[model samples]
Target: MGRPSDIPVWRHIGEAPCPPSGQERVTIAIVGAGPVGLAMALEFGRRGHQVLLLNRPDFISAGSKAICFSKRSLDIFDRLGVGDAIVEKGVSWNVGKVFWGDRPDPVYQFDMLPVKEQKRPGFLNIPQYHVEDILFDAASTLSSIDMRFGHEVTNVLPDDDGVDLEVRTSLNSYKVRADWVIACDGSRSPIRSMLGLEFEGRIFEDNFLIADIRMKGDHPSERWFWFDPPFNPGQSALMHKQPDDIWRLDFQLGWNIDRKAAVAPENVEPLVRAMLGPDVEFSREWYSIYTFQCRRIERFLHGHVIFAGDSAHLVSPFGARGCNGGFADIDNLGWKLDLILRGEAPASFLETYDEEAIVTADENIRNSTRSTDFITPKSETSRAFRDAVLELAQDFPFARPFVNSGRLSTAISYPDSGINTPDMDRWVGGVAPGSPVIDVPIGNRWLLDRLGNRFVVLADGWQGPAPDGVEIIDVGIAAETLQLIRRRFDFSPGAACLIRPDQYVAARWRTPTPALVSDALRRARGLA
Candidate 1:
C-alpha cells in the first residue's frame, strides 16, 4: 500500500530511481517501457552503452493489443533472443479469408506467402503482453539496462548537448541527463508535441467497437473480414482467432451513433449475438471503442531527442501494423544508436533513422488508411464500387487484390534509403528494394527462415568465391529449396543478392559481381 517506488530494485523490477548520490550519467535515456522503448533499451545496452528505461503504471498491460507480426519483425526479435518464447506461445497464421456482404462463407482464402527458412518463428498472432514479457525479461538480464517502471516522466527539456528529463517517483523526483533521449510514448505523445512536430492526417468518420470474446462459432481459424455484417447494414466486422481460445471481433458502429454509447456492454452484445448466433457460449476478455486515425510526425528525431512507435506515427489497427510498425522503429533505431554510441559510425547514421523510419511509418499510415477506406467507404458511389467488386471477386482472381486491399506480407524497404543500392532490380520477390515477402529455399531450408544475424548472399551459380564479409550459402539449402527460390524468387541459376542484416535486399545481380556485391554490403553497413 506504500509508494510503489519505495520498493527495492532487486526485490522486483521496481521503478525506484537509482540513488542520485552518484549522479550517474548515461549515453541514452529511453522514455516509455512499452515494446518499442524496451526494444531500444535492449539494443543500446547490447552496444555497451549506459541506458535508463522509464515507464509508468509499473506493469505490463493485460489486454492483447496487437493481432499479428511480420516475418521481418520475427527475425529481428530472433537476433535479440526474445522471439523464441513468443513464437512458442503464439499461433502462426499465414492465411486470411475475405467475405462479402451477408455471405455465409468467405469468397477468397489467401494462403500464399513466402515463408522464412530459419527454424525461427514466422508470422505470429501473439498478444502484446507476450512480447512485452519477453522483452522485459531480456532487459532485466542486462546489467547495462536499468529498467525503471513507476517513474513518470514529468518533463523533457532538450538542448544542444543532451536532453534533461524530470522523472517523478512516489518518493521524490530525479533529474537525469543523457546524450540521447528516445520518446516511445503513444499517439498522444507529450515529447513529440513539446518538439512542435506536426502530426498530419485526418480521422475516418466511421467508429468501431472491439471485444475479445470466447466463441465456439462457425468462424474459421484464419483472419476473417466480413464486408458487411448482416446486422450492421453499412459497416464491416473483423474477427480473428487468438491464443487461449479467445477471439477478437471488431464491428463498425457507424458515425451516427455516439462514441460513448456505442461501447456500452449492453449495446455491444446484440452485434455479437447477431454475428455468432444465440447458441454459442461467449465471455468477454476485454473491450474498447476505437476510431480510425492516420497521422505521422514530419520527423522521427528532433535534435538529440528521438521518437519511436505511436510517438512517431499512428496507424489504424486494420493491418495489425500499429504495434508491429513501432517494433520496426526500434529494430531500425536500435542498431543505429548502437553504432553512434560506440563510435563505430558517426551520428549521421542516426539521421537515417529519421529518414528511413519516417518513410516506412508514413507508408504504414497510408496502408492502414487504405484498409480503413475499404472497411468504411465514404460515399454511396464508393460503396457501390466496393459492392460490385466484391460481387465480381466472388469468382474472379484478378479482382481479389482490389477487394483485399491490404498487403500483409509487405516487408519494410528503403530503396533510396541510404542503406540500399540505388540500381538494384526490385522485380524479384523476397525482401528486395520493392519485394514483398516471398518463399525462397536454402538447401532444404527456406531463405527467410535461415536469414538472421549478418547479411546473407544466396548464390546458386557463383563462378568465383563469395565476396568478403558476406555469407555465401551456395549449398547450405536443399536442392528443392533452391528450386523453390528460383521459381518463386525468379532468380537465375547464377543469381546473387546482397541481403542486409535486417534481411532486406541491399543489392542484387544476375551474376556474382564483386564490386557491386562489395559496395552493397558496405552501403548496408552504412560505410558508403
Candidate 2:
C-alpha cells in the first residue's frame, strides 16, 4: 500500500528478532498519548533523542479526568514550559474545609501545606484535558519526535540490543524498532500484563459517582468533603469547582447498588437535592461511577521495557496523586534517559528510576488508601473510631487533623532517598529535608521563579562559582518575600540546598560551604 501523508517512514537498523523488517529506528517507543506519555516524549525529544509517540486513534475523549495539579507536578510542567498556560486557565485553591460527622460548621477550616509563596497561591484545579493539550502541543513542535495518533501497539519484544515493537493502524501493520520501550498505557495496561508483572492491591468494596454539573449554589470553590454524608450514612461526597462554573461532584455509591440505576436522573436528582438543600438550581453536565482500587506494579521495569503512570501504579484520586504520580514518573525518567542516551551515565542510572519512583508510588498509594478508609470505613471498629474522633474534634482543635479525609500537601518528599539527609538543620517548620521547596527573591523574584530549566543548588552563604553544569542562584530575597519565607519555612541565611530537576531537595546542609555544596551536587548527580 502507498504510504499516506501522515504515515511515519521508518529507517532500518541491524537485524532484530522481534521486528523482522522495519525501515526506521528510534531511541524509544512510548505507548499512550496521555499526559504521562506525552511528557516522556517531550523530554526525550528535547534532549535530542529520536522518539515515537503512539496511541490508538480512539483515545481522545471529551470531559475532564483530573482537575487538581500539585506543586510537585506543576514544577515538572514548569520545566517543560507548559506550566504557565495550565496555571493561567486553572483556579487556585488553598483553604480546604473539613466537616466532622454532620457538623454544621467545618471542624478544620484550613490547611497551607503547599502554599505558592507560603502566603499566596497554592494548589490549582485545572482540567486534565488542558494539561494534555499543552504537553501535546509542545511535543508536536520537536522534529525528533514522531507522534502517531491512530497507532496501536500489538506487541513489545525486548532483545539483546533493544526492543522490537509491532504497531497496527487501519490499513497496515508496521514493525518498529527502538532502543527502549516505555509503557504509560494505564492501570489495565496490556503491556504490563503482557510482561507478566503482578499488580497487587485490594479493590475497594465501595464505588463513587462523579458528575460535572452546572449548579448555581453557595458552594465555595475550595475543596469541601462532607464526612458522614446525609445522603448515605458511612459515605461522603467531594465537590470541586472547575472552569466555566462547572462543579465536579463525587458521591460514594453504597455497596450492592446497581451502578447503572444510580445515575438515572430519577436517582441522581434526589441526591443532589438532599446534598444541596432546597435553595439550589443545578443540571448535570456529565457523570461517571468509579470503583477505586489501590494497586501498583511489583516492578517498575523488566529489561528494556518500563512502566509509568497508571501503568505502573494506581492510587485513589483523593489527594490528586493518581496522574500527578505518573507525571513524577515522567520527570524522573526524562533526565535519566537524556544522561544515558548522551553516554554521560551508565544504564544503571536508569535503575534509580525504579528505586525512587516505586517507593514514592507505594507511598502515594498508601496515603490515598488511608484517605479512602477515613472517608469510607469498612469495619465496625474503624467506624466507631472514626466517629469518636470526629465527635471529639468539635471540642478540641487538636483532634481536627483527624478530619483530614484528603491528604492535601504540596510536597511528597522521599526522605530516605540517599540524596536527602535527615540531620540537615536547614529545614524548618518540620519540612522534610528530602522534598525541597525553596523561596528565592531577586528584584521581586520568588522561589520557583525561572525553575523549569534543570536541577538548581541555592548557595546563600558561599560566594563561589557553582558547579560546571548546574544552575546556581544566590537568592537575594526582598524583605517581604523573606518575611513570607520565615512564616512559611524555617531557613537561615547560611543554609543551602541541592534541588533536583523536579524541584525536590536532593540534599541540604545548615552551614554549606562551597566544598559542601559541591559535594552535595555531586552526590545528587551520583557523581560522588
Candidate 3:
C-alpha cells in the first residue's frame, strides 16, 4: 500500500484511520466525491469545520451527466470559489423555445430570467465533469477538507453519539469515526441499502437516449425542446448547447425497445443526421439509454447518519433538478450542521433540515412526474390531451401554462418553513418570507456578494444599531440600486428583513423593534 499520487493530502490504501490522538479524526465525513459531496466538504470547511470526503471511484464519472447548473447552484459556487470559472467556461442561456409538431418556429418561447439584472445567468450549460473538477480543485486547497479518492464505505455502525465507518480501499481497510456522516451517494445508494432504507415512488415505463456529440454548428445558445418532430416522430426531443462545441440531444424511446440496439452506431447515426440535417458532420462522444425513476426515502435522517443528494431522493432528469436539488441540500444542511457541531444550536435543529429538504424533494418529484407523463403519454387519451394543449399553446396565452417541456429547474421556496417568522406587515409582489432572497445589484457590488454565508439583516432606511451576531446590510448606496431594492422588497423608511445564513428570508418588517429581530434569530436557529 502507498499514498495516492493524484491527491497529495490523503492516504488511499497506505494507512487505517488515525488513532484516538491521530489528526485524521474529522468533524464530518462525507461519502461520495461527486459534486454534492465535494461541495458538502467545502461548505463545512468554509464554516470552519473539518471534513473527510470518501470517493469510491478515481474521479472518472462518464457521459457529462447533469449539464445545466441553476442560478442558486451558481450562487452557492460563488461562495465556494468556482463560480466565475464555471460561468466563463459554460454556455450561459436564459431563453427556451418549445417546438411542437412540424412548425419551423416554436409554439411559444419563455425566458428563465425575465429580470435581466441578476449577477448570474438563469442557467449555465457545462459538463458535470467540469463542475466536479472545479469543485474538487477548490476543496483541495482548503486546509479543512481532506478528499480520498478510490475509497469505498463497506460498513457503517451508528450509535447515539456518532457513526463508525469501515472504509475499504483497493488493497486495505480502515475504520474511521465521525461525529456525523452525510451520504451523498448516487441513486443506487450503497449507504441507503446498507442501512436497510428504501425509496418509495414510481419508476416510469419509458426510456430516453442521450447522444452527446462534438460538432461545430450555428445552433444558438438556448434550450430547444420538440414534441413529435419530423425527425423523431411520435416522440419528444430536447437539445442543449454545452462548452467546447459539444451538444446534448435527448430522444424519448418508448418502452420495450432493445436498449442495446437503441444505442448502436447505426441506429443513433440516423437520428442525429435527421435532427441536425443530412449534411451535418459529427462524431459521437458518448451514448446512453436511461430509464428514469422518481423516488425518495420516507425520511432522510437516520440518527447520526444522513442521506443527501441522489441517495435520499431521485427525480427524472427532465427539470435538471437532479444536481440543482443536491446543491440545495448542501446549502440547507451546511450552516445547520456547523451550528449543531459548535453547540450553538440543539441537535433537534437537524429535524428542520429533514422537514425543509423534503419539501424541496416533494416539489421536484411532483414536477418531474408530471413532465414525464406529458412527454411520454401512457394512454391514447393522454396523447390527445397533450396534443390539444400544445396546439392551443401556439395561439392562446392561457394555454401556454399547460405546455410542460420538462419545466426547467429553479430554486425551491419553503413558504411554510418551520424557521419562518411570518411577515409583521402586509406585502405584495415581492420576495416572500421563507423564500430565498432575490439577487440584486447595489452600486458596484452584487447583493449576494454582500450577503456572504452568514445570518444578516437587510435594512432599508432603518435607523438602529446592528444586532449582535447578525450583520446589517444598510443598503441603497446607489440611486438605482436603492430604487431597485425598495421595489423588490416593498419597503418603507424603517423596513428590514432577517435573512438566514443560506440567504433565505426568515422574516421581514415594514417597521421593527430590537426584541423582534432577536426572537426571529433565535427561532431561525431552531432555539425558540
Q: List TM-scores for all candidates, in order.
A: 0.88, 0.89, 0.95
Candidate 3 regions off by >4 Å? 1-24
Clashing pairs in 3: none
On TM-score, who's better, 2 or 3? 3
RMSD of 1: 3.9
User: Which candidate, 2 or 3, would have the higher lDDT against the true structure?
Assistant: 3
User: For candidate 1, lDDT tens digit of each residue in 258-323?
Assistant: 877777778888888887875668988777877768888888878899989998888888777788
Q: Model 2, 1-528: lDDT tens per residue?
A: 122344222221111122234466888999987789888898888878899888764334456487887766766777776777877888777778877556688877775444444323567887777777778778878999888876778888888778888887666787888899999888878888777779998788887888778866556669888887776566788888887778888888877889998888888877777877766788887777788889987889777888999999888888888888888898888877777777866777777788888877888888888988887787899888888878888899888877757785355567777655456463556345566565445446557655554677765554556677777665554455555554444556666667776667776666766676677766665555
Look at candidate 3 and tell me the lDDT of residue 479: 64
lDDT of 3 by residue, 80-121 (tens): 778998898999999999998799988868888878688999
Worst lDDT 10-window in candidate 1: 1-10
